[model samples]
Every structure is written in structure tokens, then in C-alpha cells.
Target: MHEGEGEIHADWVLAGRALQDVWILPGIFHGTTLRIPDAARHGWHIFWSDPLHHYYGRQLGRAVGPDIVQIGRDDTGQATRWSFSDRMPDSFTWRGETADDEAGPWQLVAEFHCRRAPA
Candidate 1:
């Protein structure tokens, strides 16, 4: 993977009330390595590099396609679910939300990475 940066928004809530809304304006990645500049403030394990890239890549048997990773955490800062989906050389769409009750179920956010096909 190439070097990149992105944003992260974490909502810390309890009993349906938002306690904190933390935003990491810039998340960094270099050569498939990921780092969260404000991880300490946002809470532990709020974000990280895809640890299952090799496993999923092996399962798919090829590297050219869209790979998706989904993560869900509850209000108590516990991971409730984690999953991934991939598509090969075509348009695709995803629906639904996170399964964790403490984490509000809302539409998932997706990031797409595409490069030009060779001639």
C-alpha cells in the first residue's frame, strides 16, 4: 500500500447519550503501516492497520480488487464485531450498519482505493 492519511471520528456514549466526540483529523499510513496521531486521546484500539490483510488476501487468491474492513466498538470501549468484504474488478455497494448495541448502528463509512488498469 502507498503512504496515505485519513480522518477518524469516535463517539463515546453511554445510555444513548454522547459523552465525547473525538476526531483524529489525520491518520497516517506508510507502506501498509498505520499510525493514529491521537490514539491516546481517542481511546485504545480505536483504529489500526488491517491486521488480516494476509489472511484475506490468501483467501481471495489475488491482490487486485476492492478490500473492505469493518469495525464496531461499544460504549465501554469494547470491540463487538469485526469483518471484511472484497470485490474483484467491478462496481460494488455495501449496506447495513454495525452490530454492537453500544455503538450506534449507522450507515458504514467506506474508503475506496483504485488504480488504473494496465494496457
Candidate 2:
């Protein structure tokens, strides 16, 4: 697998109730994601599309802990999770995992220990 660096720009929209993220992978893939909270369900509805890869999907994200948000999609029997941890003022860890089913023996797909870019 190829390992490389990318940048993400996030913004709060819908009167700060929703989050939108734009990812730049520089010739690999670029995508935009929107996350809107579903208070009744205690989770967020996630929508993303990456035209370069011809990929798009929807997922549900729920906070697993104070610093970790896990998102999963169950429609295809291929669930994916993204966990955030080790947060600091200028850095954090993001891990990606996947499983054949929602009841997972998850396999790690990627892990990024990210730091703030120099201003």
C-alpha cells in the first residue's frame, strides 16, 4: 500500500450544528464530507463522495467516548470505522478499520498521527 500525506479543511455550517470536511489527497483522491447530528438517535449522519475514486457512501457516526467517534456503514456488510484519539492542541490520532460485518473482527486499514501544519 502507498503511504502519503494529505490535508483536511473542516468547517462548521448550519449554524454550527453540522460539520463539513474537504480532503485533498493531491492526485490520489479528493473528497468532501458532511456530518449532521441526529440528536434523537444520538449519532451523526455522514455523507461523503469522492469522484476521483468513483466512491460515495453514507454512514452513521456515534461518539464512543469523549475523544473517539466511530462511524460505520452496514448496508453492504462491509462496515468501516474511524476513531479519533490522543487529541492535543495541535495534534491527534486517527485510525481506520474495516470489517466484513457490523459485528466485527476489525482489520486496520490506516492510522494517521496528525499534527497541525505550520502557519
Candidate 3:
């Protein structure tokens, strides 16, 4: 991770069990949102942190730069770029682009472990 980059957890296997911890990939930001459909096999979601009120670094997101986040596992990739301006709130709003004939329809499916923490 960078000097102030956020982190995400990654699972690991050792011996006969698995381990998990914050992602240590350098320069990668710790995404914030994790949304998905009710289907067990549906793809999951992860929202990036807010550049301003959210903990990024000493300098605000403006001083740094807007970020375009992409979520993918295989060679295929999907990307959406957004900016955090002073006029905007920390909360995020997703806006899709107008699909054109040039743009083809795409579909994705994903699976994730849904284990609830103890009360």
C-alpha cells in the first residue's frame, strides 16, 4: 500500500485452514462498498472510500486526484470513474452512461462467502 492508501482483506490458505487480512498491495486503495444480489452466485460490490471526509491522506482528494475504480478477477474488466468535489457529499451516487450501438451488452456473475459474525 502507499503511504496512506486504504486496504482490503484477502483470504489465504496454510496447513489445513485459511487466513484473512488486509490487502497489502502497494498503491491500491481500500474499497468501501460491498453490494450484491440475493443470489449466492451473484457478483459482489465494493465502493471506494470518499476522498474528503473519508480517510485518504493528509491532503484531500482534490489535491490528490479523482479515481476510477474497476472490479475484476479474470482477464475481463469493468471500469467506472467518478470525482469527489467540494460541492458533493461524502456519500456516492452511481450514474451509468447511455448505451449506444457501439457499446455491446455484457453480463457478469460472481460468488462470495456470506458468513455472519458472532453476536
Best by TM-score: 2
* lDDT at 54, model 2: 71
Candidate 2 stretches with Cα past 4 Å from truth are 74-77
In angstroms, give how far residue 96 of model 3 lies from its true place. 16
Over 4 Å off in model 3, which ranges? 1-7, 10-30, 53-119
**What's the ranking of the predictions by TM-score, best on top?**
2, 1, 3
Candidate 2 lDDT tens digits, 45-67: 98877878776767888877667
TM-score of each: 0.24, 0.85, 0.21
Better TM-score candidate (1, 2):
2
Candidate 3, clashing residue pairs? 1-26, 8-23, 32-47, 33-46, 33-47, 34-45
* lDDT comparing candidate 1 with the true structure: 0.33
- Candidate 3 versus truth, CA RMSD in Å, comes to 17.5
lDDT of 1 by residue, 1-119 (tens): 22343433334455533333232323432112122223344322223334333211111111123434334453344433333244445432322234435355544433333222354
Q: Name every residue pair that clashes in candidate 2.
A: none
**Lowest-lDDT window of 10 residues in candidate 1?**
54-63
| CA lDDT of every candidate | 0.33, 0.80, 0.29
Between candidates 1 and 3, the lDDT winner: 1
